[model samples]
Target: MDTSLDDLDHDYAASIADRAMRAMAEQRIPPTPTNFAVWFQYFAGSHDDLRNAIDLLIDHNRPFDARINQDLFETYVAPQVSAVVVDTSERLHELMGTAKDFLATAIADNHSQIQAISDVAGQGQAGVDPKALVAQLMNELARAASRATRLEAGFAEKTRELDVIRDSLSKSEQRARTDTLTGLANRRALDEFLRKAQTTAEWGEPLSVLLLDIDHFKTFNDNFGHGVGDQVLRLMAKVLREKVREQDLSARYGGEELIAVLPDTDLAACTEIAERIRRAIAEAKITRRSTGEVLPGITVSIGVARYRVGETVTDLIERCDRALYLAKGGGRNRVVTENELDRAEAAG
Candidate 1:
């Protein structure tokens, strides 16, 4: 945090983490900040004596501060840098198309359930066992509903797999950046992209970041298992993919936190997109597969903020973060932007 903060403000954790790993590699020492510092300096070639000592230590025995060194490794190790990768519109459409046919079959077989309609258009009579027929109608509807629900989960899983493959194939440089969990761009990637995007924004193009977090995630995870929690994450990811555009960059910023960087976009444009995503997720129903019980559905809180000239990525992120908290504070399942926050502040 000392002098490093000055140069590493862009990505504090990532920079130190990367250096710490390399330092550990060169020194062949256990990962510790003390060992990291000695080797961090050694790799930079700033101190000849320390570098020589580390070099000698690479072949010779050495001692390091165990606690501090361990802390450094735990703190910095680059945090599992993840990459974003996915394609969903195609598969989703296919499943939905197939589901539509299933739904039609269910409805046709159960036409008598409709109070206003006849089993045969003009035939005004439903000639079947009211009990067994009712059971049969329920079975067909349940089957169709189950098919759609299963597809929803499969869609999420396939989307994540596709994302991982896409990044692996075309974005070879980003291979190390892929997150193991969600397959979305990791926090490190988000920071890297912000650094470059900031450079272009300084020239006057609009830039914005939408900070998003899942609502009641903990309650859901606790009520269901972590497996269902993962399902919710994938569900949100698919929604993000559906709503995302060609120029947009979406990333998983740790836990249930996410981000969508929209270059050449303003607050209004960004808010509109956020609302669309909010509504889309709100309307979708996710059912428990183990039991037919309907679990509480998913919702997200979003904070939209546009970049300002001369601001660091940290500042931009912080403002957006504050707005995101505002969205969370006001109520869950809503979008709050810096524009609205500014207005509220001015009035107060």
Candidate 2:
């Protein structure tokens, strides 16, 4: 019998792992190795910087999105990016030096060949054969041309490789700001949009937020499994994408909740947009892939709240969330606005 296995605190380890996973899932974060390690350390209280950053995000009610996860990985878990950058810079410098030397040699060779042709041309046929001189000039020109071609090809290839690297890095960053499940802007992107929108609102531009939650999503998952639930979610996301204007942003606000940030839109206009989205989602249908059977129509409870000047992002979100709660309490599949909630509270 191995005593080491028994000596380990299996329960504690399991507890920590479970907590980490649930936290990730709650935030709609993929359980990639990088994300999992960051979260595990967060729950285990092993890394001070990582824990504090995550705590601040949570305290602010900020969503732990893919971008935030990558930031944490870079800032705390793997801080070797600066070292990698320095190494890359050194390699680039070395490559430049090699290229410079190669070009210098090529230029010197070409110059010498031109000088020989010039000398031959300058000789007034005293001892030079005309055909021989012509042949020598042609050879010099051919060699110079060949060298130039090779140099051009080498540089062209390197430029293509750099372009490919640039594109890959760009795509990776975009993916970090995108939700894997719904193909919408993740919470990090949403938060950034809200900040800009808040600034615009302070300048007298109207902004609004629409928070939507799928009705009875947990029950739907339990009855039809996550696969069908995912289909329902995708359907809802598609509806949102189609219903909103180009300037508006639709994003996954974590499990079963989606949001739209409407810029330059007032409360009345925002409510209209929210109602349209609600209707579209209710009309959308999803089919179960396994059985090839159509599942039930999806419905969402929507909450609309217009931005107030000088309000924090968290405060605006909380007000919108309260409207959503009212919608849920009133009855599922309805749209509620902050003004309506305010009226109700005042009456009470």
Clashes of 2: 0
- Over 175-278, each residue of candidate 1 has an lDDT whose tens digit, in order, gives 44554446667566777888888999999999998988999886887688656777778788778867979768888775678888989998899999999999
**Candidate achieving the largest TM-score:** 2
Query: Superposing all C-alpha atoms, what RMSD in Å does each candidate have to the true structure?
Result: 22.0, 7.5
Indicate the residue-level lDDT of 67 in model 2. Answer: 60
Model 2, 1-348: lDDT tens digits are 111213449987778789999998887665666687778778877677778899899899997754677678757765533454565567667667867877897789878877877787876366778888788788878887888888888877766766765676567668666877789897778989888889889988999999999999878877986667777887888888888899989998877789999999999999998999898878766778888888877789999998898889899999999999999999989999999999988989
Candidate 2, after superposition: displacement of residue 313 in Å? 2.3
TM of each candidate vs. truth? 0.52, 0.70
lDDT score at residue 293, model 1, on the 0-100 scale:
73
Off by over 4 Å in 2: 1-133
Q: How far is candidate 2 from the true structure (C-alpha RMSD, Å)?
A: 7.5
Looking at model 1, residue 107 earns an lDDT score of: 66
CA displacement after TM-score superposition, residue 89 of candidate 1 (Å): 38
In candidate 2, which residue pairs get closer than 3 Å at backbone N, Cα or C atoms, i.e. clash?
none
